[model samples]
Target: MTSVGIDFGTTNSVVAHFAAGSPAVLSSDEPPADWAGLGFDRVLPTVFGRGLDDRPIFGWQAKQRPGSLAAVKRLLRAEERAEVDGIEYSVEEIATLIFGHLKRSGAAQGVGFDQAVVTIPANSRGIARYRTKLAAGMAGVQVQALINEPTAAAMSYSMRSATEETLMVVDWGGGTLDVTILRNVEGVFMEQASKGIQKLGGLDFDSALARLVLDTVSDSDRWTQDERTGFRLDVERAKIQLSELEEVSVPLPGGQYRRITRPMYEQVIQSQVHRVREPIEQCLKDLGGSASDIDALVLVGGTCKTPLIRRFVADAVGLSPAPGIDPMTAVAEGAAVASAILGGDLDDRDFFVSTEHALGTKVLNPNVGLVFSELIPRNHKLPARATETFTPVRDFQDQLQVEVVEGDPEKPLDDDDNVVLKEWTITLPEPRAFGEISIDLTYSYDVDGILHVHGEDSLGNVVLDEAVSYGASVDKRELTRIAQRVSRTLDEDRIAGPPGPSASSLSAADRQLVNDVQAKILPFIDDAEATQLRSAVTRLEGGDASAAAELQAATRQYSYLL
Candidate 1:
């Protein structure tokens, strides 16, 4: 069976497959003449557009549209459908569009991979990874394996380089920032430590650039969506130009233009530039070493291409980067190499899976009330399973809420913001606690990188055991509808049309805010309005505070009292 590793990135998605003796990225698939009008390349954009079509329009085909959207990867756990133009679409729907684009591109090269491996950020744990797998299933390719992005990159590096050395993989892409430290022992790549900041990426850089340009304008506070979007596009383009040129003049809306030199550009995003070093520093700290301890620094992702970042990481790591592969395709190439290994094509050696986040439950502390307790710590090798026993504070506790979150277990678990995986409640027949009954939470992470959670009584009876739930996955009809939707995209692939647009990002902390605010307000709005509110909340929660605030005010002012 043909197999490939898919880096379904925040900004762009790439596919690489095992071929004659090695893995290769399908980088030469250019859009057809008609598709060329949509403005695309080998790297499929992770975006969807607003339209009247039954299926979502995506990538370049989404450009110049009114309701064009991007960043569905970050919104995977979000249950609300985004309304663009007059249509509404779920997070899975938008993701399916992106995956479908990848399928079409692969098929264009006469390679429709039946078995595939999809890679996600090391921080993309629990439900986020499950949603990724679901998206792949929607695209008609059964996932053979799921690998962390940096691990796959390391696999790629080990494949090309025979020399054994300690190397660092800094994968700063459009939506997530992940760092992995690994060693090539003989031929096997062993990850020593890993860390990530899911909310940080290229989109943040774009937004910061937007803020810099907007600051030069008088009505920055009152800027409309159209105005913000236009500035975003221009500033984003100029930022890309600054990477190649010493300086770039960006045209802001309202006939304003400013010259942004590399130094000036760096200054605008200086705070964020410093933030990039955080995960790297933290990873090194976890390894009990300094930059000098790192033998070679491997840079991957488009944002890592910026001269300022490359120079800073090189200086910070105290080592010059190894020059061989393009940073942009490094992860895709690495994932491709991993796919080959998993497919048993390359028997050089093997790699291991590491959990990106701590897996645990929220339990009542004797003195502190409810707090998080971890069963599996971050970076633990998989397939990992762990169990912890606990008893209720009350003599007779009728119910137990088993909320398993993927985050810093050291942190106090206050709300859903601390969760990335699953949350389920177990109801007991009668009041029982302490000696009356013993509760055990069992977490088993499988080979597919999926987690199976189980709660049991001391008698060994299963209380709750299942995969983590998706906001929309609970509905059987919804799952069927999504499957049908994904299948249709394959059919649309044959039509040679339906390219549209989209954007990227996500984090754990915001989950709390969404659960509290959106749920209460949902009953007040219609389907169309609810979709818009969700997109607005997703944008606002994703650091688009401006758009979210404006929409909130507009809703309050124009409401017909329900």
Candidate 2:
């Protein structure tokens, strides 16, 4: 019955629990002796590495180690496994390792680790969120729910404040930058808008500083992998030092030292820092509010420790970050608060989340080919439902293919800015003229941020209705296997030649005969029978003189279905 809050961050992760009526961060039971000295007892570096025996290592022990991966959270959307020293470990596996460690650490603190609420970036896509849940499941920890990082921070912040005020959160972590605007209405926090910039965070700052050091090196390209890693570690240290001191000397791979001034460090990261303004501005615009409307500014993530970042955010919002909210532990603490609320420990507060992207389907337009028909617009509050009516684009089109997509409402269906989440084919009762069959597509988005689609035709016949979280029900590895199986099936088909005669290879008379029978029986036949009939037509068209009898046999068999 002890549910905790876990912030699975990009640069670092933290576990917290609600004990004695307040959220408290948990320190590792077996933490490094100097972890507290380094301000890391409550923070676990999001690093994964391999030990001498090729076993896995995580957290503090894995930092800068051989075959170690830092900022692995950024790669969750791009890849599933990472090859470390000849071993391929899946992203979920790495997350499981991290979660398992956190769970044990909580257990050591006399806290139950069986169920917990986890946090993710506000703009994390469906795949990443799904994988996070999967990882927690693999770790034997049931994820009570997934909360957005900024929303959690707001929750944590709200617990300390008794006044009703609008809050803006700027979360710049190691992987992305998220800006959220929310309001405190009668003690309930409701997110009004959120914006995110991918690949903009603390790690990018490190990379920018590393590039500056590389420019000073004589033969930077020739540095071995080990040298490069060491240099990166040194650069990150120098960057941290530069935040506190006016200047610091970064040790190079060859024992050379490069002095970096805070001014110079800020200049090197100016581009990345400046990009933060866009999300902030957009979030304000999305919520129809400006700097004066925000009563408090909340900052989350270690990256906010940079003085320049703090200054930039303050100047952009015309408000300083609220006092007493620790950037390092706010998210975890907020998650813990969420846990307490869900556990019924707190009865005075609640929160509502908003959708990050527009949800809709693709419709064919005579003028534009295919256009996005938005059902639920972006920034819509969760637990929402929207229905849109569509029809067939072509006469005699017996099946309607509805493609569920999420993205900018203004973007084209095929644009890279939009993603096709799912595709469904609704078999109609019969062929009809263009625009004759009324098909209703309803998209219901639940509070968990999962999407369910309901589709039906004019006759009240249900076509398709299912919960779709980017196919989270199917494991990614299983999806890969299924894809590979399909590919092999296609390859085998190609190698075996046409299952049916190429319409091009058929004589005019044979082509007409095959097409006539196929059109007549395809509507009544099942998929397997339809495929067989097509193959028979192909044989006839392929100049198989013997194929005429086979085609005729299929025609008679299919005729019974009609």
Candidate 3:
């Protein structure tokens, strides 16, 4: 059984595992022919797109395809489903595809694995964590446990030394910013606190730069989908280049160019960079410490590579990123180490993680309706159990409804940030007056991060006890069906020969127009119309002349929107 660790990131993903008693990141043995100028072959781009065959294409192959989905982890935070090329897929299904790629990629490097310890952002709610695990399971990858990204990075950095230091990790990735404060003592790693700002990261910087480019370039209103995609790629590249160079010229359509200086880039993203300080301040507050008390600051994430961010961290913490840590791969490396620890390979070390959010139940109050009552407060040490006693507000209450929620304890019950993980109905043995009977609600969070809740009456009669489920549970049958479909898709990808020429004689420009039209109208049109358009696009890709005519008709019908 090979112990594996997977970092399914927002912008890129990596797979690593233990090799010869040390963590090793896996990479493809042979690079693709078109790998030139793209990112390192080891890091897979988190993207999805439709191929010419109308099937999904992933990773770098999806980069050129118009309308490809990128940075989709942000979508998984709040969405249950997403549409790709007129095909609706559950968010978990999309994640399954990514995991499947990592699984195969790892195998190609002679590290075949079926299970892994996956990393997630420290601020992830119960629903997102559940979906991540569900996706991994659907991909035939058993997730042994979930670890926080910042904690994993800190562990990876700390494992190299036996220093007893207070470390703060500032993990600003593509989609989120997480800050963790902890102490590494001897071989035991204990987390003190964690705070984060969601939906604020590298992608936001890219968007801001893209806006700057569009505002400077002329005829921006007439840009097509392909041009827009090309410009987006260019903006991302220039953002990276700006990190090294003081300025770079971003090429525009029609042989034009726009110059972007580092100062301008920094100004545009200054607000986001400032938001990073909030989590750090909050974490310090939770720790009851100041920046002067920290021994070192560990910076991990591609976004942290920007010079401006480094300067900001140095100015804020009065320290540089801990020496010798690869910002891009630290989290994955840490995950591999954690995989070893969880697999019982590291008996000398005691690794402990803390709860990211407060876990409790909603209680009715006379003044504020339903309010959150904390059972296990945020940053509490894990493998923890807490019991809170409650009495019915009404006389002769027949049953107790336990609304298990997770969120900031300061938030109101109706606040959208407060997520209800599960709800339970405990039938009372007999109707009793509110003041006469009391029920004890107990919550236990295990080391594996699973939560269980139970209740009992004053008479010691067990009312309800079960593992608390987070999010809406998908039927096992549905999961199996999706898994079968995914298997068939992978099989087809393996055995299918090279693609044949299209049946239609439409020129390249005509085909692109039809694609643009389809992309333009799919959202506004009805499902029936969308289906017709999808069929036309598939036929057009297959060189169907009649289908080109059908696409032309639909294009004419929806020209108003276009």
lDDT values of the candidates? 0.71, 0.76, 0.78
lDDT of each residue in 402-492, candidate 3, tens digit only: 7888888897777876888877777889768769888898889876556767788897888876555434444444555566566676552
What's the lDDT of the predicted structure labeled candidate 3?
0.78
Instruction: List, residue by residue over 1-562, the lDDT tens digit for candidate 2.
Output: 5658999989889898988888999875344553334346678888888888766677767775767887877776657578766678666667766777777677667885667899989887655676677566545566778888999999889878958999999988888889999898886889999988766888889989988877878888888888877787778777766767899888877678999899999998987899989889888898786789999999988888899999999999999889988888999998988888898997787888988888877877888788888888888888889988877879978887667877887866677658777677778876778877788878887676767777888878877665664442344334333323333422311111112333335677666667666655565445765787677766666666667656654553222111
lDDT of 1 by residue, 1-562 (tens): 5658888888777888878877788853444453343213556667677546545666655643556777778787445567666667777767866777787778888887645888888877677777788677666666777788888887777767888888899898989888899888787887778888878888999988777766777866676767766666677677777888898888766677888888888987778878867788878888898888888788888788788898988888888778886666667777777777777877887787677677777766799897777778877887889988766657788777656667786666754437755566677655665677877877898865678777888767777766665752345346446655566655753221121112233234344335534644455445665677677676866666454344444333111110
TM-score of each: 0.80, 0.79, 0.80
Clashes per model (N, Cα, C within 3 A): 14, 3, 5
Which scores greater on TM-score, model 1 or model 2? 1
TM match of model 1 to true structure:
0.80
Lowest summed lDDT across 10 adjacent residues in model 2 is found at: 489-498
Winner on TM-score between 2 and 3 is: 3
